[model samples]
Structure formats: structure tokens, C-alpha cells
Target chain A: MENEFLPRRVRIEETKMMTSLEKWFKLDAQLDFKPGQFLEISVAGAGEAPISICSWNGVEICVRKVGRVSSALHQREKGDFIGIRGPYGNGFPMKEIEGEKLILVAGGLGMAPLRSVLQYVLKNRKKYGEVTFFYGIKCLEMMLFRDELLKLMEEENVNLHIAYEIEDEEIRNLKKRFPERFHKGMVTTLFEKVKVNTESFVVVCGPPIMYKFVLKKMEELGFYKERIYMTLERRMKCGTGKCRHCVVGIGSSSKLICRDGPVFSAIDAELIRELV
Target chain B: MKFLKLKKDQIEDFFDSIHSFGIVYAPVKSDGKISFRRAQNFSDVSLEYTRSQIPPKHVILPMEEPILKFREEEYFEVVDDENKVLLGVHHCDIIAFKMLDEVYLQPPKDIYYHERIKRTLIIGLSCIPDNYCFCKATNSFYTSDGFDIFLHDCGDFYFVRVATPRGLKVTENSKNLFEKVDEKDMELFVKAEKERFERVKGKNLWMIGDLIELRDENFWKIFSERCLNCGNCTLVCPTCQCFEVYDELEEDLKSGNRFRRWDSCMLRAHGLVADGHNFRERTEERLRNRLSCKLGEMRCVGCGRCTVYCPTGIDILEIVRALKE
Candidate 1:
């Protein structure tokens, strides 16, 4: 057979620098993908990087410019094409968590992948129960999808809670746009103010450091580890399972962030020591 | 099977004939030690050496390979290589190749690795074991499988056993250089090889099982301190398959090529993420990961290539023995 593992070139439809740490690129391809599965974007001459799909339906990648491949992604334009392979890894168990009260949390660029789930849940609104989006950023300027999110909150039956670590005045102007939803302080504080049943499913995505504190708050708020889900970021080289660059957990039993999961339940990720 | 009485003088002519078919690579003396390299002459190939400074892994899995090249938004293509024959590979190195094959050639096989592997022929040489050698621990001191042809040193002549149709073709074509197999000569050769292996093992070498037990022990701390985090071990290791892919841009900024290169877990950045969190931050953890992958994870295949090419002479077998305490 021919080289089946090779990536196909897909033109970039749109490109936006999400924050100082990340960039979002929407590819001109119909990639049938789940919320948590990721794609390996190849920058010709640079290398391939496994970036999580942030868009629900179309192929879009939210990449943090951390390493060589990511930095190259930021340099490309809307018309430029890059090699695209895979919608790999186990996505969030959307089918299983349907109809349960959902608490979605996004921290900084972590919102990129979690946004996929948010969009999915929003599209199929009546299929699930109450949906609460608790998005956290270092400041208002770092917030991604600010305009889209404002529009999302305006829709009926959606409870959106946006927070920043900086002073309240920084986000005061945004109050006019999202008067009822905007809140101050850390994202975890929303757990105290919000009320939900024990059957609620909480999804969290952020830096590795954010996990411990967020998980602690979830536990205090009567959310078990199994009820909470999170995504992990690692140095992935080959999106295919060959390179073994992204294997985590103890004993180095490979959990390919590219193939196994970018999103895992809090308890399911407990064995993974380095993931936040 | 054949016990051919070709003098050492005719070895160059054999290599010359093999070179006509394809490029032949073998261990050649470099600096003070031997390393696998393209062979220009038979005199440079060292079959008597214990082990080379580098495994023959690079012949298949190159240190730097271009997965694909792209020029702006116009064109993109991948580069494929030609066929070659690798000669004088040790049993340990061959076993390492097998381990690599199991991983890369598994379900959803890697096209890049498969392309190079398909065009290559493996010729294994049975060498007398040395103090540093511990292939027997992994049950790969001598391999009758995984090779197209197996060669054993029988005094003045070389005993060749063809294991594949390709190997049989090469032998049949060189009929003038080989003699028919004699039962008496085969028995004597096997007996001599067994005695040689036993003599090598009698020297107080480390046991493989002891190393497996020490994987969780405190012995890692001592070894970790000595490691400069240079990644030399992973670079020299034949079975270390970890890699990183990145894009390199030209001055125009509109075009670039994506390439994947060898990466090592021993490096500080191997486990680091974009947000500045390093999974294996401690030297002890990185060192332990490398050892465990070599001993426990890769133990079933029995490829001792890692032990053979360690620059610091960090015998993993010895480390495991120390851990057993």
C-alpha cells in the first residue's frame, strides 16, 4: 500500500492569535471529530505537533507557541496550507455525560480544547441539562472568543461565568456586554456561588498547575474525581504512536496524549503524575 | 548451512562482490573505538570487536530525516531512499532492531520507518562475548532468527547459515567461495561457540533479573548524579525511539519543511510542556525511566544494544545488580 500514515495538506481558512501564549487556526477541511480528540499539524521543514481541536465540527487547532512546531504555526497566514493528520485520542465522553448538569471550566489557553465541548453542548442544547461555563484567564486581555462567548451568553438557558485574576476594573467594561455573567476572582470561586445536583458533570482544562487547586475545590463542592474531567498538555512529536514522546503516567506505560486522550476524568488521570 | 574454508585473504573480494549489489555498512574503527559506518574496504571492518560506540540503528532510523518538504503554498513532497545491505551486525543490535520493528511496524505502521526497513537486508555476525556484553541476559547472545544470514567464525573459515530466500540467493551466487556443509565441522563449531560463551559468562557479570528488581530502588540516585543530562545514552541506544518534529522556516517566511529528529528522554526538555511544566524534572526520574525502558519494558525482546554503546560504560546490568541490594 501507499504511505497511509502521511498527512494531507489542508489550507487555513482563518487564523487568530488567541493570546500571547497561543494561536488558533481554522483549517478548510471537514474533519469529523469529537470534542477532546487532537490533530497533528505539520509545518513543512519544522516538524509535526499534536494540537487539540478547539472547534466542534470543522478542523481547527488551538496551539500554544511553546516549542518549534507551535512557533512555526503562528507565522503562517490564512491562505497557507499545513500538513494535517488525525483527530486522534479519546475525546470527552459526551454521550455518557449527556442530560447531566454540566460545569465547563477553561483556564487561559486551556479554553481552546474545552471550547469544542462548549460549542457541542451549545449546539445540542436540549439534549443535555443545565450548562454552566466558568472561564478563567489571567486578565481580561487574555480571554479568547470574547465576542463569540458574549453572543453565547445572550442565548436563553445558558449560564456563563467569566472571571479574571486581575482587578475588577479591568473587566468592568465587559459587564455592559455580559452584565449578569461576569464575575471576579479565580474560576474555582464559582463552585461556591453556583448550585448544582450531585449528578452534575464538571469538565476542566488548564495548565498542569491549575489541576490540584481546581480538583481540591471540586472535591469540597461534593464533586467526585470520576464526575470531573480535565485535559493535559505534553511535548508530543509524532501524532502517530511511533515517537513515544507523549507517554505519561507511572512505569512509562504509554498514554499517548495524541491517541489515548487529551481529555480524561479527574480520577482516570490520577495515575498520571505530571498532568495538572 | 556450509563450512567454507575461504582464507582471510579472500574476505575483501567477498565484500567487494556484496558492495556491487548495494552499499555495505559495517563497524569501522573510529578514534579509539569502533562505530557502524559505510565500509570502503574490508580492512576497516572489525568483526573481533566487543561492541561499537554506536548501534547500527542509524542505518534504518537516521539521526536526521526529512518527513516532507514544502515550498510555500505551491508544492510538497516526501523523500524516499534506496535499498542497502548492512553487514557484520551483532546479535544484540539485531535484537534491538526487532524491538524497534515490533513498535514501528505494529498496527498503523509508521510509513517513514517502514520505507527504510523494507529496502534493507540484515547480515548478522556471531562474535565472542566480552566482559561488557550481556546479551545472554536478554536471551539474545546468539540469534538464529531476525536475520537473513547468520555467520559464525570457525577458525580459518566462516560458517554461513542462510535463513531467508534472499540469503540463499547470495550464497548460491557465491558458490565458488563456499564449500558443502560437513556434519563433523558443524558439531565442532557449535561446541567451540558454547565454550566461548561460557568463558565470557564466568567473569562476574551482572544478571538481568537482579536489574529488574533494582528498578524501584535508590541506586538510581547515584547514577543520576553522574549523568550530565547529555542524552548520549539515548543517542547511542538502538532501541530508543523517542523523537521530536519541528518546522524550519527560510527568510521568505512563506515556505518550510517539516522534519523529525531523534530526541532523548534523558534531555531536560524531553518531558517539558509548553506551559513550562516538566514531567520528568528530576535527573533521578529521567535516569530511572531510561533504565526501566531498557531492562523491564524491552526485556522480553532481549536486545542488549543499550548496554553495548553506552559512552560512560554505564552497564545497565551492573546498575540493576546494584539495585538488587
Candidate 2:
């Protein structure tokens, strides 16, 4: 009999600017959640927006200043209190991918959710096979969790590949310093440089347009449709299924994205064409 | 279930007595539109109507409702506890009400909706279909549940089928207001039901095979061009439950109310995400999504309100018939 719309207050313990548009916040609450699950962040007068949980241990979320609620979040200081409800949606299938090779593909802001899975995978490194990380951004400035991605480059059994669209003097210098790890093009460009395992479980997250190209490249590289998992983003008003705004698929196959998924298999995404 | 008969002349007394239980909301003709309104007396109620422009759903899920009130760091829930009696609801709308219950009353139930629905009583009235009605095609012309009491017109009396304890309470309190149904009364009830069943020969637009499979571009193009996206169809739909939640602040900006307003998927803003990406950018895509969602879940009760209320005359049954062809 709990009210599903009610949000509990959580004070911000810390805040960091990841980019001009994306800001990171660490709350003073500990939430037990899976990787791809998102939080419905509430700013009283501004409204609510869904933010992806970017950290593994505590309540941390990445907010991009795109609309009203997120812009309000950007104006708040470290100690300001905000309302939060749910670590909703079916997150990544962490248990299913155990002992399988993980190829994490993140585009721009998509790194937030993938970061949660990456940290979980690295902590239990011996359980999994190899970890391949491919991150693509518009430029070096837009790269989220830059220091973390750099540190991940040195982790054992993990191969990190990065691609940036713009190649300025700074990007050129960085590319020269790390020739084998950096490439200049779309994230799909990194696929050709690496020796992909046909059996690897590929997890992708990114903008709407990026999915089509990335999935096509994965198909070309001989990855099974069922093995490729991607978390999708949709306009969700309520985290629960009652609000039909986040519905995907058609007819009997129709499923609420907020309840059934934020992460879905490539096969489901194929069947529900709206997901990609 | 119990069968009782109330004389046609006794309806006014029954209506007045039910006020003791709760506020009575029934069909009323006002400003050239027949809609549900609070009945102060039986004279204000209209029994002869095809359908209300806006459904009685607003009795439970209002067009605009406040779920929470926030002041600084504290938040409180705004729950309505008033008891209500929604009477004269058609069979199709009763089925539509059950569909709304299935969504809101499922796991992780909506407390606001639960509170309103629990406090309200529903009374179903048998209605003969007009040209706009296709409830028979949707299998919603006849309903055995989702109503406390059902009244079937039988000439001088109404054959009352009491399906719930709340319904029985009204008859019990009224004493001699309702009489026991005899064999002749049963025959009249059967004849009345038959007349209603035969009257619903509107359109046999029963949904064909998977509508998602019928995603023919040319077929959608002809209809999408005519769609104004005014969202009148969704507003009048009994089963369209999509909503948008937002907060409105006072002038001081210290306090605000979090409100959920009825929203339509036909609007562009419904599917637009944060990063300026709209999943349903074009009118064709929105139209397809709406039709497919309706067919997929069997959400369309075929009340034909959407067709009647639409400014562009985009008949849904016509589209369904074309798909069948």
C-alpha cells in the first residue's frame, strides 16, 4: 500500500562537472541496485527527471542539462536535498554474463550506466574472461569519467579503446601518446582494430542514432543477436508501468520500457523496433 | 447475485435515497452535451443518452490531480477520501473502467487511484448502440462485472441485478422500493436484453491479425496527413491513461504541488527525450504507435468516442476494416 509516486529525500554529498552539459552527483544514501537501473530524481518546484545510476557502491547519478528538471539540478549546490524514488527497470543481466567475455561499448553520455557494470566486472575480474571497453565521444571534452577510463586502461585482462570525432592539437598529442588505444572516427571504427570474440557478450549504450550503426557493426563482426545487450533511453514520466508513455513494441508484444526494460537483448530490440 | 425489480415511477425515490450512501453522479444534458454531473435531484438526470463526451473516468482519475505537496524538504500525499456513486455508466465504459483498474491496481499500485476507486460505487445501465458505437465488435457490449448494480430497462420497471454488497445495501435500506422478480419479469428482462443486443449492429470492425504486421507505409500515409494531432481523441477515450507529471510552485517558490495531468501520445512532446531525440517524430509514426498499442493490448473498447470527437473525421473502425480487407 505504499504510494509509488512518493519520493524519499536524499541530500547531495558531492557534485562534479563531467562536461559542459553533464554533471555528476553523489547522494548521502546507499541504494542496492543493478547496473543499468535508473533513479527518478525530483527537484520540488522544477519537476522530476530520470537519471542513470553511474556508481556501484553508493547513490550516484549523472544528469545532463537538457530539460527543466535537469537544469534545476545543475543549479543546486552540494548540500541541497532532492527527492529520489526507485532504482527502477530491469538492469543489466549481471548473473547471466558471468564467465563470459564483456565488450562494453559506450557513446558519449552513455558511459554513465556502463561505468556501473565496468566497476562490478573489474571487482570480480577472475570470474569473467576478458573485458574489452570501447568508448566514443564527440571530443575529448565530452569524455565522461576521464580519469576512471584512464585508470581502467591499465587494468589486467582489460583492453580499452577510445574514439573521438574531433582531432585537435590536444587530441592529436593524446593519440600520439596512446597510439594503440585511441582512434579517430565513430565508435564503430574501434571494431576493426580489435580481435573480437564471437562468443563475447556485447553491452552498448548511447544516443538514439548510435544504436543503428553500432548494432550493424556488431552484426558484421559476427556477434549473435541474442548475445548483444543494449540499454535504451525513452521519455518516462512514471517509473511504474501505469503511465503508458514509455510503451514499446506493438500489439501483444507491447511492453512498458520503464518496467520491462531499460536494457534489452538485440533480438527484443529487433522485434520491438522502437527500442533502437 | 440477486434479481429485483424497481417500478419506473420509483426511480426518483431510489435516486433520492442513494444520496445517504454518497454523492450521486449521473448523466445530465447541459449546454447541448450529455455529460456526467452531480445530481441534486432525479429531474436533473438523463437516462437516454448514447455516450458522454468525456467518460466518468475523471471521477477516479481526474484530468488534473495533485499527488504530492512539497514545502522545503518535506512532502505530503494528497489523497481524496470522499465516497461517490457513479451511475448510468454504459457497458463499454464499465469494461474500460476495469482496464484502467488492471493498470493502476497492479503491483506497485497507485495510492491516489486506489483511494478514489475504493470510495466510489459504479452503477451500469444498459444502452442501445448508436451509429458511432462498436462495443459489440470489441466484445464489450455486455458485461457481467465491474459494476455494483446493473439496470436493464423492462417497460414499466427496471430489472436490477445486484452484484455487490454495496448494491444490496441500497435496496435493503429502501425496503419496499424494490420487489422480487417473478417469471414475467424474467421474460421481460430477457426480451430487453435481446433488443439491446440486436440494436448494436453498427460495424463488424473486429480487429484483424497482428496490426503491427500491417505497418504498410502507404496505408498510414493517407491517414497521418489528415491527423491534426489536436489530441481530442485521447481526452475523450475512457482507456487512454497516459499522463505527464510536473510541479507548479507558488509565487514564493518555497512550496509547490506535484501534479499529474492527462497526456496524449499523439503530441510530439510525449516521445521526445532529453537529448533532443524524438522516437516518434512524424505524425505517421505517432498514428502507427497509437493504433498498434490499441490493438496490442486490446485497449480500444470501440466506444467510437475518438471517431466522434476527432476534428478531422479519422474513423478508427474504417482503418481497422481496411486492414481486415
Candidate 3:
């Protein structure tokens, strides 16, 4: 047999330093990817790493320089080519929540993938019920996509709430720029203040630890397991199912994250011991 | 149809004749244990050996084969190799390879695996019952359908049975190496083989049905403590086919090759993520996955190769028994 898989080289058009550790890259092509699906990004000699596509419409990835591949990506400039394999893994199941209210919760870099779904909802606003966005970060400096988010929040029929963990001077000064958008507390605390309907479809993405706490709050707030969804991250070697690197515990069987899901309903994921 | 009656001394001549056909590999003694290697003489082949330290899968699916090569600006191309023969394969190993063939050559065929597989011929030797073997439990101790040629060792001679066209061709070419078999010789060979397997069954290793049912039982905590997490069981297992892929590049960063290597679920990092989350972090969880893959998955064809190669001699059968309790 012969290997049939292919790798495509895509050019990065623009780069924005989202935070101290994270940078956003806008590529030249409109990569047909769903929200919460990730791309296996390769930097020739360094290594290949999987990065979730944080922005839709345009292909962009918010990469944190944590490992060799991510660090190499941070050092690269615009017009450089990066090998991309896929927009793999199951993304947010928007079809199941089409007619329900939407609640989006993102913590720190979690906003990256969720930003895609949030953008989709905004572009097709009339298709869904009330939309509420709750985003939290470490400090004012760590907040990403500030200008674009500000413009999005200003748009009619959108309700956006932001929070930070820090009580620093820079945050105090920046609080004046958007008085209504800023709040100081943990992201889960904001859940109590927001009004959510019983039929609301909640989408959550964040560090695994943060999701545990936030998901508990959502459950307490009367959200059924079926109405909640989460995007989980795992080490993926081949975005295709051949490598078998990204199998996650789902119910009684191990589900390949590349094929079965990166996005799973809370009910489907509840039996997974590690996720809980 | 004929029965080969070559004295033990003439085994060397038999191997020399087969070598003219193509590359023939057999288990040879290395570091006091038998390992499958290129055979130059019959003295190097061990027909009475228990099992090879490594599975025969490597002869078909190499550990680190470059599936494809690509240039940055040009289209990618795959690599394929052909024409090889593996000799003296144990019954369990043959069954294990058959399982691999089903997986890799199934729908959405793995081209790389198929290229090597199609080029190779399998020559199997019926195994004498060993202390560690539990192949009977997995119903793979002896396979009548998998091998191209099956050889039964009878005191001073080899009873060769050709099963495939390739096996028949090999026999036809070595037409001078056999004599017509009589009913007396066949009866004696069958009686000896049955007695050999019956001795193995008397060891109580074959009664593992109750243990198999308790594979998912929560008694793994007790059994997991002994697991060194060394990953010896998975590496030696013929049917364990999990893998990890990565890319290597030239220093100039202008070109690179994506490659995949064998990976085991027994390791901690196998289940780790880029975002600092690991699902099977604990040793127990890793152990559970390993057991589930072997027993619960029902994928293991009961090769008994894992038990033979395990350094600690961790009897998976014993673990199953503990689970039953």
C-alpha cells in the first residue's frame, strides 16, 4: 500500500500578539474548519503540533509558545509557510442548539476556539435565541482580541460580559475605557449574575481545570447535561485516525478524539473519569 | 502429496535449497535467546524454540518505515517494498499476523502495510507446548487456515503440509526431498502432537474463560501496583498496533519528513494533551487501558507472545484470575 495523505503549505498573512505568551495568525486561505476543530501545524524541522482554529471565516490560530512547535511558530514572521494537515475532530454541534438560547463561556486562551462559534452566532443572529458571552482572563494585559471584541460588543443584539482575576493599576485604568464591559472576579462567579433559560445551549472551552469548576456551576444553574458541550484538548499526532494518538475516554469505550470528537456533550463526556 | 523424511543432519541441505528462492529469515539464537533474523544456514534456525523475542510483524510492518516523502513545493509520494519470505513462524505469531492483516489491509487499506505484506510469504511451524503459552484460551494455538505451509517436527523428519499455491510451488521445486507417507507414520505423528498439547492443557493455563469475563472488574488496583510501567507487555505484544506520528526536518528548515513510530498506551504521555491535561495519567488508568485493549477489546488473538517476552514474567493470565476474584 502507498501513503495517500497530503500536507498543504499555507502562508501567514498577518500576525497579532494576542498576549504575552499567545499570538494570533491570520492565514491567506479560508480554511474550511468548524469551531473547536484544530489544525496540525508543522514548522519544518522543529516539530508538528495541533492548534485549535480560534477564528472562523478567516483561518487564524491563537498559538501559545509552550513547546518547540509553538515556540517556532512564535518566532516566524508573516509570509512564511507552515504545513497544515486538517481541520479535524468534531467541532461544536451547532445544529442541535439551533433554536435554543446560547451561552458561551471561555476562560483565558479558551476564548480562541469559542470565538469562532460566537462569530458564527453573531453573523446569523436571527437563527438562535438570546446570546450571552462570558469571557475571563488573568489581567488586562492578557485580554486578547480587545479591539475586535469591543467592536463586536457594540453591535446591536449582542450581550458581552468580561472579567479578570487581577485587581491591578493597569486594569483599573483600562476599566474606564469600557465601563459596562469590564468586571473583576472569577468567570464562574458571573454565571450567578447572568439570566439563562432552561432551554439554553451552553458552550464551554478552557483549560481542563477551569472547565471542571465552570461546568459544575452550569450544572447547578439548572443546565442539563445534554444542553452543555465542551471542547477537550489532547496530544494529536495525526489529525487523521491512523496514528491513534488522541483517544479519549468516552462512556465505556475509548473514543478517538480526531474522529469521534474534540467537542462532546456533557452527557456523553460525563462517564469519562479524567474529564470530570 | 508426499511426506519429507530428511534426517536431522540433512536439515542444513533443506535450508540451503530454500535460500535460492529468495530472502529467508528464521529465528536464530542471540544473547542466549532466540530472535528472528536473516538465516544463512540451517544451524542458525531453531525449529524447537518456544517463540521469538519479537513478533514477526516487523517483517511485514517495519517499526520505523518512511511511508511517504515530500518536497515543500512539489507533490508527495509514498514508498513501497516487495519480495520477502519469513520462515519457521510459530503458530501463535502466524495468528497474530493474520489479525494485523485484517486490520491494516481492511477497508481504507493501509497502503504501506499492504506493500510489505503482499511481497512476503509465511512458513509456519507447529509449536510444542510451552509453560507460558495460553494460546488455547484465545483459540489460536494452532491455525489450519493462516499459513502458506505448515511443518510438523517428527523425531528425525519434518512432516510438511502445503496449504497455498506458493507452498505447493516450493514443494514442487524440492521434489527430491520427500517420500510417500504411510498410515502408520501419520498416526504416530498425530498421537505425539496431541500428547504434547494435552500436557500444556494439564498446566491449568487453558482454563481462563472465567478470568476473561472479569477483565473489566475493578480489582485492577491490586494488580496495577506490580506494573512497573515499563511498557514491556505492549512492545512485545504482536497485536498491539497503537502509534504516534511526528515530523523531522533538515537544519535549513526548507524540507522535512513526517514519520510515525510505535507508541504504547502504557506510557503516561501517550494520553497527555498539548494543554497540560492527561486522561490516563495514573498508572492504574494506563494499566486499565492496556488490559481493556487486550481482553475487553477482544482484539487479542491469544498469541502468548507477550507472556514469552515479558521481562518480569507478568502473566496476563494471572492478572485475569485476580480480576475474577
Tell me the TM-score of each prediction against the true structure.
0.88, 0.98, 0.86
lDDT of 1 by residue, A215-261 (tens): 88877767778888887777666666777767665444436676676
Best by TM-score: 2
Candidates in order, interface RMSD in Å? 3.4, 1.2, 4.1
**Candidate 1 clash total?**
17
Cα lDDT tens digits for candidate 1, B151-214: 7777766677778777777766676876766786678678768876784553233443335433
Most lDDT-accurate candidate: 2
Q: Which stretches of candidate 3 lie over 4 Å from their true place?
A: A1-5, A173-180, A250-252, B1-22, B67-78, B101-109, B144-147, B152-224, B247-257, B304-313
Q: Output per-candidate TM-scores for chain A, rounded to 2 decimals.
A: 0.91, 0.97, 0.93
Best by DockQ: 2
Model 3: clashing residue pairs? Answer: A1-B111, A1-B115, A2-B111
lDDT of 2 at B230: 91
**Per-residue accuracy of model 2 over B1-325 as CA lDDT, tens digit each:** 9899999999889888888878889999998787888998899899878889999899889999999999965678999998899989999999999999999998899998899888888888988678888888788988998989888888889999999999888789997889999999999999998888787765564445375455577788888899999999889999999999999998889898999999999999888899888888888888888887666568878888999999999998778877776
| Ranking according to TM-score, highest score first | 2, 1, 3
Better of 1 and 2 by DockQ: 2
* Stretches of candidate 1 exceeding 4 Å from the true structure: A1-7, A16-23, A45-47, A64-72, A173-180, A220-224, A272-276, B1-13, B199-219, B248-257, B299-315
Q: Is the docking of candidate 2 incorrect, acceptable, medium or high quality?
A: medium
- iRMSD of prediction 3: 4.1
Alpha-carbon error at B58 in model 1, in Å?
Answer: 0.8
Across A95-155, the per-residue lDDT of candidate 3 in tens digits comes to: 7778789989898888999999987887778889988889988887888788888786777
